[model samples]
Target chain A: MVTISCRDLDVDLGGRRVLSAIDLDFAAGALVGVIGPNGAGKSTLARAMLNLVPTAGGSVAIDGAELVGLAPSHVARRVAYLPQGQEIHWPLSVERLVGLGRLPHLAPFSRIGPVDQAAIESAMAQTGTLPLRERIATELSGGERARVMLARALATEAPALIVDEPLASLDPGHQIEVMALLAARARAGGLVLVILHDLAAAARYCDRLVLLHHGRVVGDGAAGDVLSDAALDAVYGISAWRGEAEGAPLFVPLRRRD
Target chain B: MSLLLPLLLMFALLSGLLSIAVGPAHIGLPAMVAAIEGKGDPIVRAILLDLRLPRAILGLVVGAMLGAGGAALQGYLRNPLAEPAILGISSTAALGAVIAIYFKLADTYSWLVPLFAVIGAVLALIPLLALSARGESALTLILAGVALSTLAGAGISLALNLAPNPFAAMEITSWLLGSLEDRSFKDVLIAAPCVAIGLALLLGQGRALDALSLGEDGARSLGTDLRRTRLQMLAGIAIGVGGAVAVSGAIGFVGLIVPHLVRPLTDRSPSAVLLPSAVAGALLLTTADIAVRLVPTAMPLKLGVLTALVGVPFFVRHLLRERRLW
Candidate 1:
């Protein structure tokens, strides 16, 4: 079982504390959505957990080992990350682009062998991007690019995947499909931590929700408990529709609260 | 993919042979063979061993360093317009060599010039490394490179303006034209080691550069030590390109144009682009050197001038036509 935990983590950027007293734990076989309003430091929190940002206090641990000072390759072997709003700089084919995910596993100067090829192919298949293998990645449409990026992350086959804002700029249909892919990944025993903006989608699909406001964790737990009417009204300054639809718990944000 | 390198290598080899064959000497193939056996005519022996061979080898080595250096710089900065000459790196090395000449240090010690050139290259690379680390835009990096190039040019111009004597000034001015004329085996010995180290360093970075196409953060996330990669690339470009400039003045635009000409053949993968660029660089330079020989002029065209003539136009076209590619 995989376990990622942050205990009272604090992060300072440019002499300003971006996150403070943030404590979070992620376990295997769960999709956890991190939700927050603007400037809530959600991205900062994710970066901290990945050891991308320096911690001012406390520690992050993956499987009981401190993440700070850990080799990036060691972290990559266990946790795959898909950063937000990525831009490809080359016109590499989709096949080669996703194949780069196997770098941490291969030795220097070595070619990708059959095992790596299999993993790359499977990742493309899983994300429905196999057909785009020959296409230049920089020329793809937005939805296709998102899927290709997801495929690249999946090719790592790491136990835990942390993605920031994967749904941004995607249309509704593509959004649901991507969400389903993440949900399936979690169900298949991967720990998936995603930063999401759609509260209803987070409520409907995630096993838990984390709410951050101004670098503080204001709410955490089941979506129903964390995204309550009072919680939404107090934190977001808005009233949201909360009910059940087709036996799945549903939530839709409405007008602002006074 | 496999055949591409061999093809370029063959082309470079032919260029080298052409460089050796087409000089102002009348050494036949039989005499060339006898010369290798040390029994040919003394004039033919001097022509082969002293004049043409070193020039051909220098052309090959300098060309490869430039080509590979350009491709590597482009990969590191993620900008197609990035090259040692256009970015002023070679000028810095040339400036270092000029300082050695201006101070007359080369008369005291022959090795001091390339050493100073390497030092000059590494010193100038500091601002570039810091700027790239800040993850600036392509345009910003290019602008900064242009500024550095301009500053280096001004420094060179100032040195030319204040020579100790007319002869000293002539020596300095001619060297800046970037020719491989009248070079000897000693010059080859001086340039080879630095180029070898730099080339090895450059070629080893293919995998890291491939990963870096994802950007610094993405490459870092994939377990690449961004700091180490940058340091290695910096050392490679400085030592190799700097050494090239030290021995043969400033041959501009070989690095700039070679990689662009080669990128389409390699699917634009930065890693795959480097070696072919090196080979193509050698081919282009050796060919240009040959052209320098054939051009009908009072004084034959300088290698630097021809490459700049071709490169500046191509660079402008690249800016206009392919802004979206990078």
Candidate 2:
């Protein structure tokens, strides 16, 4: 089991505070969704957890080990990160792209061996991208590309998975597939944290929701407990209906009263 | 057959042997080999050992350096079009050599030529690197490289025009054209160490180059330190091209062509491209140098001219395809 704890974490970007003093804990076997409006530091928080961005103040620890003390490859082994706007300038096959995830695990100067191949195959199978492995990743449709990228992350076999806006380009069917994959991973005792713009999707699939506004966490708890009308209005300046369908939490944004 | 490596090696050996033997005089292979082994007639021994052997070896080294240098540049910039010439490193080094030669600085102190050339190559790299980093895009880096090439070309042309005498002017022009002609053991001795150091640096950074292809920000997010990689690339380029241009007078196209030729052999991975490019480069230049000697012409053509002559067609073909894989 893994636990990620961020204590009073602050990040400064372009002379502006992008993430204020924030504290949160993500335990293994939980799906935590970060929901916020644009520029609410969702991506920043994910990046900070990966140590992609420099931390301005406070600390982050993964399973009681300080994130700062870990090397990148070591961090990569424990915590896999999928950035929102990943792009490859060159055309590479999906398999090759996914195989890159095994980099942190392999020894320097070592070629990809049978163990890596097995992991890649398992990852492709898990994400249902096995048939598309030979195709060029850039040539795939948007939803297919998203799955391939997730497969790449899964190839790492990391305990803690952090995804930034993973649902952005996914279609409805693929969206559920991805969310189901994350939920499956969480049920299998992995920590799944995702930043999502779709409140309804977040409410439906996520076990807990963390709301952010202006670089600070506004609310954190079970989805139903946190997605209150007042909190939604204060954070997003809009009221959202909270309900349930088929035993899944559901949210619907309401227009201001005429 | 994917046996290009063995084929290239065979051709390089054949060229090296043929070059030492079939000079202006008809010294046969047996005689040349005997001479090089220090057991032939005095005249043949002098000709082979004192002259032809160094020239052939220098060609081999310069070619290897250019090939390896080109591969590294392409890998670092993630631009297939990047070459020693395209990036202006060769021109800058050529200019440094010319200045040293024309001012009689090399005559006074033999080490000055390569020293100045290396410095000039490093100097040229600074602006290119700086310009590329401003916008943090690979396209901007290529543009900056082109701009440096233009400026460095103008500097070389102006230097040639301002030469003190006809002999200096001729030497300068020939150096600009780039050749392995009349190079002695001394020149070979001066170039070998630098080229070796450069190749070592490039080959060592092979995996790092693979990481870099994902872009600097991506690599950093994956835990690579960008500043360190950039410095290592700079040091590699300076040593490789600096040594090559010092000996061969700015041979072009080898750096550009060798990578493309070897990329397929290495399954298109940037890390796999490094050493294979070096080997392919050595073979190509050695064959071209031999071709120059064997073509039955009054004057042996410059090695640079031979490479450009061969490279232009392939370059055009790549351009027509519009793949930018080269």
Candidate 3:
């Protein structure tokens, strides 16, 4: 199985040490959730893995290959990404936007063939966006746009998918639906790594949890083992209750007493 | 859809022939056909082959290059408003051309203008791109481009105002307004190769441009080398836009408008937008050239005026629409 491993990674952004000696491993066929407070360097970790930002020290390796040594097209074909800041230039149709996922696989002068079309259609269908294929992505609602972006990542059909705050701005129903989709993707033997701020959703959906506090990995293990009350209180400086709701783990953040 | 290329090719040929036939000399279709087959009168053949054909071909090449260059820039920068005109290349080239003209450099060496224009365009890109690429937002890049363009414009105006001869000032003014007037086959020969190579470079990077559209972070994660992509794009813009602006004198909007027009044909994929934009640009400039020749005027109409007249409305509509959305 393929795995993304980072060893003693440090990241500096705008002259600030956003992350310090970050060490972690993300394995295949796992729904790995990264939970952290604001400014905790979760996004920085994701960027470092993608090689979008340079590491001040140490290195990241994917499937035994150093990230720095791999070509972009090679990495692109194996790893699909969904960025947090989504901005589409034109009112491209849903099908058209999703079809872009095949870009890495196609030659520069080539057109989309039957295989590409099939992939596009499958991605749209997987995200339940087939009915909206003709609609413009820019005109879609926030949740719909998020789904469209997810479909773009799915269209890559990569073994590994990384999404940053995919549930942000999504409604509760759509959030659950998207989380279920991620879980299913992981179950089907694809790696799915997501950055999330919602502790309850992270507790309920992800099989494994990686928590960051001030750029260091505070906890890493199965969700049940890593997401204890003490850990939450220490990381967030707040009290929280953990329990079960409808056969799934549920987390409730207590209101501040002060 | 597959038929688009052949269809556009056919139109390009037809429009080209129509351009030769409709000028003041009024060479009919039969005469034009004979000229093509090399059976017409020598003068008629010379006019068609030597005079009109090169001008038409030059327009086509320059337009296609600019269009392709603009598409590449917008895709690479991930900004819709990015184009040669707005990004300072054209204006810098214009300033270079003005310098060439005012110093009587064009009189001594006709090729000096295009060469300096090219160098000036590349020079402008070096600083502008460096400033923008170093942790600047897309908006900041556009703003920087505007500032540079204004500086170039002011420089051109200063050069014109300080010219020693009245003829030089008039030439500079007319050139600044932009034209393809009195252009000969030699001008066409000079620009064709640069434009062709630039277009090839841009088209070669189509897949890279697609990756860029997904945003810098997304593109990076997808294995796109951002620095290399930026370098390729800058080189292509310098060659294509520099050559076009050197020859055509800052024709606007072909780059900005062509992609929006052909996007649907390629299903809005940036990778797909390159060639269709090239063809669309060729058609547009050829048609505009034909219009200038057809308009009944004692003096020839400037091609830039027509493009701006058409482009301004579209730009306004786009801005209004963008406002509504944002």
Candidate 4:
């Protein structure tokens, strides 16, 4: 089992303190959703965990191994990160695009051998991107591209996965599928942390939710505990419609609170 | 990609041989081989060894440098339009050579021309790199390159205007047009080392370039060092193109067009196309040099002229398609 712990972690972007003295712990085999309104430092916390952003204070450790000063490849090997947006620069085939995830594992001059090949195939299968392997990723539809990108991250076969804002701009069906995939990954004994906006989806699928507001974690616990009306009003200035559908609890933002 | 690589190699080898065998006086294959095995007539050996052989080898090496340099730049900047010439590197290197020629600096050290050219290429790269470091658009970086090219052009013109005599001015003009004509083994030795260093640096970036296809953030997350990659790539361009310009006088377009020609066969993966593009560049340049020798004209058509003649149409088509990038 793997664990990521952040102790009083602080992050600085430009000259501003974007993340301040944040403490959190993530254990394996759980689906944790990080939810916040825009500019609430949800992304910053994720970045700080991976050491992608500059950390000004405190420490991050993966299974008690200090994450700071770790090489990016080393970090990538232990944790797969799928950054926000569907921005692909080249018109590479989906197979090659996904194969790129094996980069941190392979020697610099070495070709992708049978082991890497199996991983590539497995990731594609997991994401249902096997049939789209030959298609150019840039030309793929939004849902398909999202899946392919997730496949690229999965190809790393990392035990810990962090994806940022994955549901944005995807259709509702695709959004549901994406969330289900994250939950399934967690169920299969992996740590899956996702930054998402859909509170209902998070409530339905996520085992836990961490709420952020203005560079600080306001609440962390089960959806019922963290998505309380008072927390919602203070953090997002909105009220959530807490109810149930298909025997699953749903939390929908009802209205903006002044 | 596997099938395409050998095919490109075959074409490059054939063109290299053609470059050696099909010069102004056709030294047939048998004669060329005999001369190499130390059995041909002495004059034939001199023509083959002292002249055509070096020229042919230089063509292959310089052409490969241009091609590889283009591929590396295109891959890093993620733009099909990037090449040493368009990025102002070639022009700055040419300015270095012109300065060496104008000041008669080569009369003593003889290697000073190429060394200065390498320096010039590096000098031009500094500003371009600085602009890119500020997170400017590719268009802005390219425009900065254009400005550098214009400045180098003005510098070359100053050298031309202050030429000691008409003969010296004519030599500068011909050299600026670029050719492998009359270049000896010494030229090859001087250029090959620098080119070799540069090519090694560029070709080494294969994995990093592949990772970079996912954009800067994506590549970084995949363990690619974007900063180190950019610096190494820029250094490779400067040193490689510097050596090439010192010898061949800034041959253009081979770097730009060869990648376009070869990309389709490599699944368009930027890294996968690097080697094929280099080989294809060697083939195209060697053939073009041979054509200049065979094509009847009052004066031999400049290799740069031929390359631009061929390369401009491709550039125009690419611009039209990628105009949205600007």
Error of 1 at A42 (Å): 1.3
What would the per-residue lDDT of candidate 4 be over residues A1-258, giving only the tens digit for each residue? 889999998888888988887899999899999999899899889888887776899999988889876788888898998988867877788999999999999987898999999999999987889999998888888889989999999999889999998887788887888888899999999999999888888899999999988899899999999999889888888987888889878877889986
Write candidate 1's Cα lDDT for B172-244 as tens digits.
Answer: 7887889988888888887888789889999999888888888766787788877788778877887888778
Backbone N/Cα/C clashes per model: 0, 0, 1, 0
Q: Write the per-residue lDDT of candidate 1 for residues A98-178, one digit (tens) a residue.
A: 988988898988989999999999999988898999999998988788888888888988999999888877788878888
Please list all clashing residue pairs in model 1, or write none if there are none.
none
| Candidate with the larger lDDT of 1 and 3 | 1
TM-score of each: 0.94, 0.89, 0.93, 0.93
Estimate candidate 2's alpha-carbon lDDT, on a 0 to 1 scale.
0.80
Candidate 2, residue A17: Cα displacement in angstroms equals 2.6
- Candidate 2's TM-score reads 0.89
> Candidate 2 on B94-166: residue-level lDDT in tens?
7788788778797788778777787778788788777755444556766776787788778877877888788
In model 2, chain B matches the true chain B with a TM-score of 0.88
**Poorly placed runs, candidate 1 (over 4 Å):** B86-88, B106-112, B125-151, B313-326
| Residue B113 displacement (Å), model 3 | 2.3
- Model 4 complex DockQ against the native: 0.55
**Where is model 4 more than 4 Å wrong at Cα?**
B28-30, B107-110, B123-154, B157-169, B314-326
Position B132, candidate 2: lDDT: 57
